[model samples]
Target chain A: MVSAAGGGRVLADQDVCVGAGQCARVAPGVFDQADDGLVVLLVRDVPAGEVDAVLDAVDRCPSGAVRLGAPAGGPY
Target chain B: MTTTDPGAATAQPGPQDDVPDFPVPRSCPFSPPQTYAGVRERDALTRVRVHGGKHAWLVARFEDVRTALAHPGASSDARNPAFPALGAGEQQVAAELRPFIRMDPPDHTQVRRMLVGEFTLRRVQALRPEIEAVCAEQVEHLLSRPQPADLVADYANRVSTTVICRLLGVPMEDLEFFRRVTSVSGSRTATAQEVGAALQELFGLLDRLIDLKAVTPGDDLVSRLVNGPLARGEITRTSLLSQIGITLNAGHETSRNAIPLAALDLLRHPDQLDLLRADPSLWPDAVDELLRHLSVADVITLRVATQDIALSVGTIPAGDAFIALLAGANHDPAVFDEPERLDVRRAQRHHVAFGHGVHQCVGQNLGRVELEIALRTLLERVPSLRLAVPESELPMRGASAIFGLDEVPVTW
Candidate 1:
């Protein structure tokens, strides 16, 4: 389970999110739920310290809404 | 219940050779159905006979189950006629009511969106104190009871009923009415007419309550919906009624079953209970583990393929009904190492017990909060809580849509 330590972005697609709120619960620092229960990315860039949390959020997202994007330079 | 055409089963994905029953009952009461393991071992989708002897594809593997649920070709619309219903009555009633749970988007999306704000993480977190208070009050009631109290009837049922009622602004005096409603409507043996009658009364009650809420809105979900979606004309009064009905039912049913069953599971494994008792912080993860292990609401994830959808394992042809067994997915050996054993610290959180895709349980946040509080309060307040009867003697509900214990007789 490699942490998202390589500079990468956290992408939350509202279209795909079913609003299960796993992201907000598992990684409150990086994700939050909008009023409509859709995922709201609090921070676009994953912080070094929050990498593991972000990874967990990605893994736990039921609808595949939350994902770890490629390193900053690569295609998102 | 109509039997499937003999040739139809052969036309499906799996072999024409011997199709076992659809909802293979759990032999151990607490474990997944015995047939699932054999079904999962096969490469093709295993067709099984449902309530009506109708053929349905059983998606029994973890990855395949997820794929089936999340697949765009899959349809939850009950009107499809092929939608798998363990109860003969459910398909007709659900098709008539058109609850969002049985509808595909954008209809499902629109209805669900209007209600999601009410159950957001922030909102549920705010409701924690009230949930905790409810659990604490139930504890007092349980403690006052004589020896060998039924936790299912005495505590779990009451806590779930009160919490859902309060959330929906339903008067407590009518709690027993709801018990009847759920019982009649949830029964697999109930005829279509009986289920319709039960829901008719339910709708009537909500309709009257909606009128009252419109006049004098409160801080509850019913009032919020009455003042917002219904008032705005974005949703019809009829649609609003069914939405609230489904919400109220879904809100409580899962928790009512999960709590005592989880308690029983923990009690059965004293080592797991001791671990949680040692570190109360493990309660949240432990709750998740319990939900995954129990997977009580396994059968509710029923669907029909609107179009042929190919997965890595196999394809579900169009118009074919399928049931994504949540228990099968939860107990998958590939994802969950030693799936049967209860390990509270198991880091897995992607269980389909709340289900998958857009139709996932909306009240799940609130559900988690209530379960955590209810179990923690019970464990803390009654340290000596143990089964009053032998574990083998407890009655497990095998006929209903939700898996649960009929009564958990306990004495501390």
Candidate 2:
């Protein structure tokens, strides 16, 4: 779901994830856990309203697996 | 077994024989208190012996324990044959999944360097406002909930888990499962079968995620680690798993124990609680004091002596193992005056709760930020927060290595 706040892409790197379950804690609507418990992104494009929260989650990731793209959508 | 050769130096005297004591059990379980009461009574640096099967040195003195921790011969390798004891077969399985915290020097240094930037004060500070907000939201949630709420399970545990999950880039929906897995891992009672099952399940999950990252690299730490410096034959798959395991293991439990203990201590001492309430600026110092006083991880960091070493208290011969008792050291009179008293204003920068030197908890700064926010927000939002049951009724001490209450029943 690309947010109108200027749709931007959010990439979640699965390799470095130790499954600490943080992104889900911060933005439950956007991040979901698979049956195996690893994180799965619910949405690729983040709305403007949720950008700040998503960015916050990105910054907090210990494994640095989360990245946010520009509204126009390019490589994070 | 056999005493040191007569020509060799005499080992340090252990606990005075006159002191009452109990045998160190065959298994190192976390529940029921381990026999550290005698050790606690001695000076922070007292040399004591614990009889499990053989005599094991117990470093209770603050200074001596610190010295032992930094000593060149203190080995972090679990592979050491002389290593005293571990909880279950899970230790072996867990060993295969070893994290950097369990490794010594060179490897530990390199792995930690990669993570050092992510946990820096600058990064942690950036999350301060968010941490405060999370604390406020949790407090509000608690206030709205039914009374006699278990603070450890509900608030403290949740807060730490949430923060750590965010740091690890895990998805939101998976937080509950991840928390459950980590909780089980933290328990000493967990069977090896349970541990293996959990590990297999976790690894399977990680495998898929790793595959995804390999194909579509993101800007997250995982992607960076996969493609960046670690890609050049420096880091391996097994090594990556180890780091992840360590990060998750340390991320929540330590903070979970510390937060409620600090709360309980402050609540028990209304004077300190009142002072903290009156001056929010004292929150940072208050946290340091609580860490020093509670020292929730009471189990000493394990170390095996590689060579005979002498100290003011006694001598520890090569091959003997010892534990640096943080709780005992924190209360050592030699280090802190009125060691048992909780003084929010006390100068406690030298405390070893996060440890010292190379193995010091890498997440200490992040832990402090989380703690300060939790304490301040809890006090501010739930001014009437107090234990719902008598202190005696509460499960204040952990049955495992990480000490804290099983349930902190509280009412707003």
Candidate 3:
């Protein structure tokens, strides 16, 4: 289910995260890493200004862990 | 999904004579192999002959290379008969030791998890002070040397070796020994026997260090692995040694090659160097730009397909070997504007120089920090640094696994 926040939904799956920290490095405003180096999402909804950076994080992430969720009311 | 036996597939057909040889040597140290420009221009997957006269699929476009790497069907397992080992001993080394970089999931994941915490962003950030100190010490050594000093040997190698040694908790008493080991193990021309001997000597020392760390652990990578993974039975003693060896080698080799090559790039383009000097904040971006430009570890990222994988350019059939040319992807004009130009403020940090996918360089954060500090210190301290000899006369390691200059003669 989408968070339905003010901005687009941002998803980070810790289970598959390889802890490469590309997300945290590429989009620090939206993502961080735990002490164990797993991805920890700081924001559920991506701010408009940070969308490009968040997209870059998705592209740069070695593991398919960080991604943008489908728009609200879109297919699950 | 049907899995074709790689051995059977290889036995069926030989590569066409038209297939170009893999690892076309770079005409200039600052650029990738001149061949990559033509390959990338095709915007498609191509076949190239590798070790043992075998053909492997080569992905050169930026997006296609990333796709090949990110695909789960791509396997790093060296045991696969179709796996490409650029050097004679490389396959044997990977098969015998089973380093996680040459492993697939579950196994790769298990070993990688135990080490990621050590190289996290925050953890590496904390090492900035120590790295700065190492660079400062090396710069002083450079100053003490006579004019026309060898920057590669005097400063770059020393700083990299010292930093990695401290991180691994290895004593600096055997720096020369470690250098000899990497020189042989990393050489593409080294015979299987020579590489085996070099690795044996290295493992012998690491074996002793692991034994010591088991009983007397410290706040270092070896100690942590000793206490955490080995004690937990997640990894065997032999595998642990292999992991540490790769980390130690990786921790230094890329940076050792990068530092001197990057300095030369700056020396070649004084305007870019001036841009960095004026706004010191641009140092980090400059380091990345240099890494992208130099692409020293161009041919190191080797892979083979486990299942048929489709790319925008073409489909890589299962049981076939493949390689993602990092140098090609980094220089793709479609991805980078004026790819040949070295712009410090390029704002492009997505280069695959550290590689892409799960097996990307684990020590990348540390590598980034180390390079940033080393180059910045060199430029900041030695403002008048310039090439002591014509760039044409500089010796390059043309056929080695890692690309770099044998010596960068410079004076201030």
Docking class of 2: incorrect
Worst 10 residues of 1 chain B by lDDT: B1-10
For model 2 chain B, the run of ten residues with the poorest summed lDDT: B22-31
lDDT of 1 by residue, A1-76 (tens): 2344636888989988888888899899999998888999887688888988888888778778888877666676
Give the higher-lDDT candidate: 1 or 3: 3
Per-residue lDDT tens digits for candidate 1, residues B57-99, read 7787888887888888889998986778888698888998888
Native-to-model Cα distance after best TM-score fit, residue B137 in candidate 2, in Å: 2.5
State every prediction's TM-score relative to the real structure: 0.94, 0.75, 0.94
> Residue B306 in candidate 3 has what lDDT?
84
Error of 1 at A57 (Å): 2.1
- Enumerate residue pairs that collide in model 1: none
lDDT on C-alpha atoms for all candidate structures: 0.84, 0.65, 0.85
lDDT, candidate 3, B1-412, per-residue tens: 1122333333123533466777787788888888888777763466777777767877888888888898999999998888888887778778877888899998998888988888899999999999999999999999999998999889999999999989888877855566678888888777778888998998988999999998998989999989988998989998998899888887777788899999889989999998988899888889889999999988887888888878766678888888899999999998999999999999777899988888988788899999999998998999899999988888998767788888988999
lDDT of 2: 0.65
